[model samples]
Target: MSNEQKQYLKKLKNTKIKILFWQILLIIIFIFLWELLVNIGVISSFIFSSPSRIFKTIIELINNNNFFIHIFITLKEVLIAFILGISLGFLIAIILYQFKLFARIIDPYLTMLNSLPKVALGPLIIIVCGANSKSIILMALLINLIVSIITIYNGFLTTPSYQLKLFKSLNASKLQILTHLVIPNSYQTIIASFKLCVAQTLVGVIMGEFLVSKQGIGYLIVYGKQVFNLNYVMTGIILLALISYLLYKLIVILEKKLLKHI
Candidate 1:
């Protein structure tokens, strides 16, 4: 590579290293403050557990093999809902793009549905799905689908007019255009939409679990609160954060791999 390219790569590496360092530093500082507050009695241990206490709870739960079970259950629900929701959303977007009149007709209603609080549907979903994994998956699917559809639709619609015209002039079929131009052009947007959908799906799953289920991380959180075990609650929060971060990292890696050629 050229000297300039080498320098640029080095700079990028340094920037990423600095970012990681600061993130770790900030976490340590926060933990220190948390411990200090508990030690000073500024925050009651019962209501606001320290980081150390949460860590202990996490360790104990892991030792009992309960943490992995809850994590796996929640992860399963999230994965199922995320895949189904995104696939359905993509199919819907393609259908809408093919029919402009339908897209125009449903635009306002889609916006309203997206704006509605998904948590409000949890009880009804539980009633219909009978308070099981299906309820959690459906809840997440409902919340994620609207956003994904809107985003992917917008991405598809925003495919450059020039490219479409070119494809038409070249006598390209609809499938050919979609494969070669539309999907590639909208790749970034679709990935971004997936990232957002992941977060919303997690929220939906947790809310569903909170309102209905007897297992999963949200159930653990509710149980902890009921028993006044703030450490357990904090442990759940930490675990959720860790899982979300890992999911985000996986998305980033996938994005890089998929977009490398583009």
Candidate 2:
């Protein structure tokens, strides 16, 4: 409604456009440089595959009818793990928030488990779940679940003290206070947890795939290594990077939509 506000919005839009332009330009430059260096013999194509070689590898995978299969498998695992992680984490965080004594009792153990290297549990997971997708999903679930709990639980704890006192003074029930005040106040944190969960889920899925999968990008990377085909490895990495970027962008869009009210 005001000229100043309109100009500020225009300026912000231009800044975002400039940022996108630079990001795309940087990727193009990097690819061009990589290809140029490989062509000039500055880097061994066998070890550090060229962008063109990666493209060829992707084409080869497509011709072999494995490209979509691999992508689909990995994406499915990621989606399943992400949803489970967030849901379980949210439930657990709520329980912890409601029970201060229990939260204190388990805090150290949670910290320990979080700090432990998850890959170390791979062999045990395979032993228990068998060498299948179950193991992969479990491995991914184990990795992301703890992180979601911690991030979201901490977010819940950050509810304003004054608000808590006000709710108490109003004789509100605990559930009413939580529903009306605490959870609503942590919407940003919950969305932030979603972003973290997405990335963590991807990492877990890849790790699980590496350990037990016959299909997926992680399997592709391992297979490439065994066959001494660095191009496949590079292509897998590129595909993963693209997947991660797209997933992050989706979360950002979701964040914008969800937090528009805030």
Candidate 3:
């Protein structure tokens, strides 16, 4: 590589490191301020819940042997919903891309479904799926599937028309054209959809848990609210934030690896 290119790459790396450093620093400062305010009389420790209080709550949950169980349940539900949503969405998007008439026909319906508030269906879902993990997974699917289909299908739609015509003139099969040109070019869009689906799936899972779960972080938050123990609520929120951040970082890693292979 040229010296200019090497220097550019080094500068980019340093920028990323600087951004990460600031992010961590901001979180530390926020936590320190929170603890300090709680220790003083500025903020109510009972309502706001200090960083140390949240730490103690974590220890208490660990001692009770319920912490991991809750985390495991929520993670499992999220994983299942996420995988199903993406797989089905990808397949359906391919179908829509191949059949233009079908795509046009369902376009309005998809938009309507996308705009619908999924939480409103919680009662019906609980009634049908019986207040279990099935309901949770189904809720998440409903939330994420339409979005995945729309995002990926739109990406596929952006495939170059000249390339499509060229492939057609050469008697290339639609499958060959899609595999070689469409999907490869849409990797970024698919990855973007993955990120969106991750967030949507989490929201759906939590909403389902709020409605009818016996275990999971959502249930813990609800339980804490019922008993007026805001620390547990705060702890659940913090855990969720951490989980979301980790999941997003994992997706970023996946994107890098996939792009490298491409």
Candidate 4:
């Protein structure tokens, strides 16, 4: 490589480092200020729990052997919802794209469902799917599935017309063209959808938990509110944040690997 290219790369690396440094510094400063405010009686710990108290509550949860159970329940719901959402969405999108008549027919219905607020269906879903974890997964599906189908379907629609004609001229079947061109070309869109699906699934699961779950982080938040335990509420929120970040980071890693080709 040329000296100029090496120097440019080094500069970019240094810039990334500077960004990371500032992010950490800001978090530390914010935590310090928050603790200071709580310690000085500016904010009551009962209503607004400090970072230390949040950490302490987490520790207590660990000691009680309840941390992993709650985390696991939520994670299970999220993973199942994510998998089903993406797979079903992608499959349905392919079918719709191949059959333009079907696509046009259902376009309005899909649009309607996507815009509908999913929470309103919670009770009906629980009534049908039962009050157990299936309802939670279905709740997540209600959110993630529609979003995924719309995103991927639109991405599929963006395939170049010239390329489609070329494939047609060569006597390529719709499935063959889709496998060879449309789907492969839409990797960035699919990967982007993954990030959104994870978050939506999490939201759905938490909402479901709020309504039906006896255990899980969402339940903890509700229970905390009932008992006026800000520590529990704060801890539940912190854990939820951590879970979201970890899921997002995993997608980032996958994006790096897949998007490098882009």
Candidate 5:
């Protein structure tokens, strides 16, 4: 490769290294403050367990093989719900884009649905889905699907008119225009939507699990609360935060790849 390309790569590597270091530093600072507050008796250990206690709880759970099972259950539900929600959202967006009148008619209902709390529908989902993993996944999908559809549909609608006109002048069919123009123009927006949807889906799944299920991280949290095991609750919260952060990083990687051509 050229010298300029080598320099660019080196700079990018240095920037990433700096970012990682700062993130670690921030985490350390937060933990230090947490420990300090606990040691100073400013925070009640009963309600807010120290980070060190949480670490011990994490170790105990790991030794018992319970941590992995709970993590796997939550991850499975989140992944399934996220995929289903995104797929259905994209499909609906395409259909609505094709029929503007239908989109207009259903817009208010979509807004109302989005505004509704997914937790409120837990009982109904459990009744329909038999109080299993499917209930949690369905709740998450219900929470995330409307948001994704709105975001992606807006992206589709906002594809530059000039580009669409050019495609039309070229006698491009609807599919050709969609493939070459709509998707490329909306790529960034779709990535953002996916990132946001993933976070919301996680929240929705956890809430569903907390309300209706006997497994998963959310259930672990509830169990911890019932038994006054604040450390386990904190451990579950920390694990959820770490998983969400990792997913966000993956979304960032995807965004970079998608934006390269633009």
Candidate 6:
């Protein structure tokens, strides 16, 4: 590599380190401020709760051996929903791309479904799928599937016409063109949409749990609210945020590896 490129990469690494340091520093400051506010009577510890109390609540749950069960249940739901949603969405998008007439016919309906509030259909979903984890997974699929299809299908559609014509001139079949050009070109969009899907699926799982769940972080949040235990509510939200961040990072790693192959 050229010295200029080496220098540029070094600078970028330094910049990333600086940003990460600031992010950690900011979080520390925020948490310190929150704890201080509650300790100083600026905020109500009884209702708003403090970081210390929340931490203690988390510890209690851990000691009781209930925390991991809840986390595992929620994680399982998210994983299943995420995998199924992406797989089904990718296949459907490919099919739609292969059949232009069908795509055109379903375009409006897809948009409408994507725009609809998944929560509004919560009761119907639970009834149809039964009041269990199945319902939760189905709810997540409903929330995630349409968006995934639209994002990927649009990416596929964005393949350059010139590229298609060039392939046709070479006597390439439709599958050959798609595999060689379109799908490869759409990798960035697919990864980006997967990132969005991760978060959306989490939301869907939590919403499903809210409607009908005996366990999971979502159930903890709902139960906390019912009993006025704000610490559990805060802890649930914190855990969800942590899980989402980790999932996003995992997807980023996946993207990097896939892009390397591409």
Clashes of each: 0, 0, 0, 0, 0, 0
Write one digit per residue (lDDT tens) for candidate 5, span 1-262: 9999999999999999999999999999999999999999999988899998998888898999898999999999999999998889889998998899999999999999989876888888889898789889998999899999999999999998888999999999999988889877898878988997999899899998887778789999999988988887888899899999998899999889879988
Better of 4 and 6 by TM-score: 4
The TM-scores of all predictions, comma-separated, are: 0.93, 0.95, 0.94, 0.96, 0.92, 0.94
| RMSD of model 6 against the true structure | 2.0
Compare the candidates by TM-score and give the number of the best one. 4
Instruction: Judge candidate 6 against the unseen true structure and give its global Cα lDDT, from 0 to 1.
Output: 0.94
Superposition TM-score, candidate 6 onto the true structure: 0.94
1-262 per-residue lDDT for model 1 (tens digits)? 9999999999999999999999999999999999998999998988888888988888898899888899999999999999998899999998998899999998899999999998887778877889688998899999999999999989997898898999999999999998899888999999998999899889988888888787899988999999988887888888899899998899999999988977
Cα displacement (Å) at residue 237, model 6: 0.6
Q: Identify the superior model by lDDT, candidate 2 or candidate 5.
A: 2
Candidate 3 differs from the real structure by a C-alpha RMSD in angstroms, to one decimal, of 2.1
lDDT of 4 by residue, 1-262 (tens): 9999999999999999999999999999999998999999999989999999988888899999998999998998899999999999999989888899999999899999999999999999999999999999999999999999989988999999999999999999967999999998899899889989999999999999999988888989988999999898988898999999999999999999887967
Question: Residue-wise lDDT of candidate 6 within 90-155, one digit each (tens)?
Answer: 999999999999999988998899999989999998889899999999999999999889899989
What is candidate 2's TM-score against the reference?
A: 0.95
Between prediction 1 and prediction 4, which has the larger lDDT?
Answer: 4
Instruction: Please give the lDDT score for candidate 4.
Output: 0.93
Question: Which has the higher lDDT value, candidate number 2 or candidate number 6?
Answer: 2
TM-score: the better of candidates 3 and 4: 4
Worst 10 residues of 1 by lDDT: 118-127
Q: Rank the candidates by TM-score, best first.
A: 4, 2, 6, 3, 1, 5
Backbone clash tally (model 2):
0
TM-score result, candidate 3 = 0.94
Displacement of the residue 229 alpha carbon in candidate 1, Å: 1.0
TM-score of 5: 0.92
Better of 2 and 4 by TM-score: 4
Residue range 1-262, candidate 2, lDDT tens digits: 7999999999999999999999999999999999999999999999999999998888989999999999999999999999999999999999999998999999999999999989999999999999999999999999999999999999999999999999999999999998999899998999999998999899999999999989999999999999999988999999999999999999999989988989
lDDT of 3 at 127: 95
lDDT per residue for candidate 3 within 50-129, as digits (tens), equals 99999999999999999999999999999999999999999999999999999999889999999999899989998999
